[model samples]
Target: SQKIEQNSEALNIQEGKTATLTCNYTNYSPAYLQWYRQDPGRGPVFLLLIRENEKEKRKERLKVTFDTTLKQSLFHITASQPADSATYLCAFNDYKLSFGAGTTVTVRA
Candidate 1:
């Protein structure tokens, strides 16, 4: 079976600092890795996508990865702000996209 694990707890941090979150999995082979941001009850908005062939991909202040050997992916937000507070999800695109529970990030000023 395939499973993904992101931080289930909320991440509280000071504004203007970097936030790092993790995503781990077991018994899964994914073609690509993806990261998304979700606010309150809204659906997840795509942030970045990294292919299995690639080590890393970035957009603006977001970064992501796909490690087949380790069965994990990492996400990072640089110079985070209060406005960046939201739930972060890591997913893998194998056949369909599958997501982790998500980690809520709270940036305080």
Candidate 2:
């Protein structure tokens, strides 16, 4: 009965600032969580993955935090640029696999 939720609105931010997006779910236990970035009219591209046992993970300008107890995952982009603007998705595979609604980020100078 777990359900996932992401920001449905577009996020607009100034260049050089960080953008934070959120994913929250309830009522289920997940083994792993994956994040992906998708551009308009293009397929999603993988960003990072965090296992259920991992609390925090970072890769370059990206960071992810997974809290199994709270059933939440946070995705961050540091020193964001216009090129980083895209829809960010959080997904986890169970039997059928599921994805969040995705949050679109727009960075402007």
TM-score of each: 0.93, 0.94
Q: Which stretches of candidate 1 lie over 4 Å from their true place?
A: none
Which residue runs of candidate 2 sit more than 4 Å off their true CA positions?
Answer: none
The residue-by-residue lDDT of candidate 1 on 1-109, one tens digit each, is 8889998778999989899999998887777888989999899998888888888888888877667789888898999989999999888886688999999999999
Instruction: Report, for every candidate in turn, its global Cα lDDT versus the true structure.
Output: 0.88, 0.92
- Please give the TM-score that candidate 1 achieves against the real structure: 0.93
Instruction: State which candidate has the highest TM-score.
Output: 2
- Across residues 1-109, which tens digit of lDDT does each residue of candidate 2 receive? 6788998888999999999999998877889999999999999898899999899999999999998887899999999999998899999887766899999999998
Q: What TM-score number comes out for model 2?
A: 0.94
In Å, residue 83's CA in model 1 sits off its true spot by: 0.8
Error of 1 at 101 (Å): 0.1
